[model samples]
Target: MSEANKDLMEKYMKEVALRRKYHEQLVELKGNIRVLCRVKPVLKEDQQEEGQAVVVTTDPNNESALSVINKGKARAFELDKVFHPQATQEEVFQEIGPLVTSCIDGYHVCIFAYGQTGSGKTYTMEGSVENPGINQRALKHLFNEIEERKDMWSYTVNVSSVEIYNELLRDLLSKDGEKLDIKINPDGTGQLHVPGLRVTEVKGFQHIKKVLAKARRNRITFGTKMNQHSSRSHALLCITVHGTDLANGSKTTGKLNLVDLAGSERVWKSGAEGERLKEAQNINRSLLALGDVIQALRGNQTHIPFRNSRLTYLLQDSLGKGNKTAMVVQVSALESNVGETLCSLKFAQKVCRVELGPAHVTISFRMTRDAMPYKTSQR
Candidate 1:
């Protein structure tokens, strides 16, 4: 590159950095914890159901509010954002693109989809190849963001996938489907770490796609009365970004967690039995524990109950202080699902009120890497 070209690139980078700083200010003004509601489209099967009626409606005047007609009375709920039935996957990703990119700047960010069975949580988190969802879009965005900053910083992206089933943590990227355990870092950082979990270092979006595909194959799903191929476990995709400033050699680590929670459905409705019954019980219990933790956080309690469940405990770092978190509560518009939809919206409303404080960039002088027992390819 010519000296003149180098100077021009440097000037452009400075401008980009300044613009990002202003954008961060705007995001901070919005809040650290965001709660979004997405009303899943009424599918053909939902239409075929005898009792299926349109009970949920979006407020045209208020994009942030939704109304549900339950017990012949309409109740309105407000959230940080609301996606109507016609909203496309691209539209949903656009709303969260900024949050995804924030991880490149060393912020711990987590976005999870929560809802009842077959309410489209998985679809929203992992859309079809024709229209990829947040997980794919977020990683691709990070790749572009990193490439733009390559002259100023060098980064390594590590990916890990885990499933929480029956209150047990399992490595979703492992061939043997190994059960895992969470422990505090021995170095006294008070950070949680999962032992025996698989972490893959991806050079770019293609590598991430392969990693996600393998994890998806290993995730547990089952046929239930509520829906076919229902997720039996909470699937969590954790992406950690490690960057070293080229100018100063200072290092920073940021993490982005994309979680697809297991369906929060009633046992009687799902007709769960035997092993399925056990799974449903655990899933509901863990979700309840999560709600309790959120309630404690909203009340500013001294104890947050992070250890009440494995799902909550594993997400301690991301859910606790100085982290950006968002929840996309997926709901169905079918009247048959009105009760579950109401429950999901109410939960989202509660989550919206919990202030997680401002997220800080994590920088450290220590240079360390996790021991890799699995395959990790880099460019």
Candidate 2:
């Protein structure tokens, strides 16, 4: 072999050794499906008279428990973690950062934000551009780690953004609202494919930021009585990282799914009519299907109904047999919204009970020069 080829071989060997060490360490760590509750403070407009005070309170004795009082009656729910209304963006991400990093360790991971209309789900997942949110922060950290490990391994990153609107899958990165189909193979690998969806190869954080901006412009959003800017569809941002060992050509592919589900709302409560009513029904139906899937997993049923809805069908892989998952439930603290708040908390409570077996790393071997990974480029 030539001198350059010899050096590349040495680097690949080092990466292989590092990956094996990481796999051993990851196997020893416990991976639990977790649900975190976040309560948004009452807005100025939501402030009521003395008799109608905020109904939600964090338990002083138990940090993970919260009580919601309605009509002089109080109900309590417990979760893996609870963030009071006073919690900052940084504090929230601190709890979630580790889960995002697990993708770099070769585990498929999903993070979901679930709540009712007017709740803070959108704020928690995609904060203002000035402050940045979990998605942006996670991308920044992933690229940083990739740079730090460039000596031993090289990584290719690709991103795709899509939304489920009125029970149809639409690619948010496409020029128009292009419909996409979900394909499930019976190969026993639990693989899902969206054939025509646009996947952009992103070089770094800056590239991702631009792609996100373009996707946001194409996302479906509208005003509702509950909130001025309500997301009208369920949006999913998928990041695929393919890592290769320079010397041995050992490869690992990890997918990180960041989902922002459209707010779950009652049609009558949201005053839906005509097109709005149709959209609301579709959203609620898909969400109900998701809830059913979660319940089935928790019950360890013989058959999972992942095929019930397009959203669930698309997510069958990350949520099914061997992946790490986390959910952040956002709730409103206003007394008037107590009913919806309770429903959201109950859904989250059920989600916490569902468990998948320990996450497994995806590893493969290939010839060094013929690896053929996608080149990271700008749109």
Candidate 3:
């Protein structure tokens, strides 16, 4: 082999070593779905006149347990991880950083935020511009990793953002508010495709930051009794990474889905009317469907109901039998919202019990022959 070819082969070998290292680390971290609970601090304005009494507290004995006090009774719930109101955005991301990195090693990953209105779901997923939250941190880490591996592998990253409002899918990146159609690919990959969605090829963190800003502006939000600017739809941000081994003829495709579900709320509590009422009902309906899917998965049912909701349908691949998933359940600590907090925690508990089969890497290799240089077979 020529000098250039020899150098390329050495680089490829190094890439293979790095990939194997990541793969072994991922295997150690793989398991059933994980659930994390985060408690939001009670704002001064929301505090009772006499400090009626704080209703939520973390267990001193167990860091992963939360104590919820109501009417002189205390109940404890356990989770994979629990973040107190004082936890910083950086602290929260530290726990999930490994799962995010696994995507680069060819594993599908889905991270979702679930909670009641006025809870900390949005805050945890998308914090202030100065202290960006999980989505931003994950993207930055992913880009940095890509840069480090640029010498051995070439990567193409594309991003697509969409929102589900009133059971309809709208492209958050598009200028017009047009409903998009979703199709299930019949190629046996069990992937859902949004035909008209505008996916942008992102070069780096700055490019993705601009796309995120545009999507946030286009997302549907409205005022509610609990939150002034409550999200009226479930917004999903998808990052598709396609990597090619430069020296060896191999390819890998991985996807990371960051979802911010609209807060689950009661219609009467929110005092919804007209459009708001419709939005609330739809949101609740989709959440209910999600609950059903989780229940079925937990029971190890032969047929999982991914088709019950648009959100579930679109996420069939990621939530199915062989992917890594994590959920951050946000809760409010105010006494007034105790009931809703309990409900959110219960749902999270169920989510924690659902078992997704062992995670697998989605990578394929190509064989080169003297006669057929371009032929490839997926393994």
Q: Name the best candidate (by TM-score).
A: 1
Candidate 3, poorest ten consecutive residues by summed lDDT? 359-368
By lDDT rank, best first, the candidates go: 1, 3, 2
Per-residue accuracy of model 3 over 214-286 as CA lDDT, tens digit each: 8887764322322434366788999989999886759988889999998876765757688778778888889
User: Which candidate model has the greater lDDT, 1 or 3?
Assistant: 1
The lDDT, on a scale of 0 to 1, for candidate 2 is: 0.79
Instruction: Give the Cα RMSD of candidate 3.
Output: 13.4
Candidate 2 residue runs with Cα over 4 Å from true position: 1-31, 48-51, 185-190, 220-230, 269-274, 354-379
Model 1, C-alpha of 144: deviation from truth (Å):
0.7
Give each model's whole-structure lDDT. Answer: 0.83, 0.79, 0.80
| Candidate 1 structure quality by residue, lDDT tens digits, 77-152 | 9888999999999999988888877788888888889998788888899999898899999999999999988988
- Ten contiguous residues with the weakest lDDT in model 1: 361-370
Candidate 2, backbone clash total: 2
User: What value does the lDDT take at residue 190 in candidate 2?
Assistant: 58
Question: 2 or 3: which has the higher lDDT?
Answer: 3
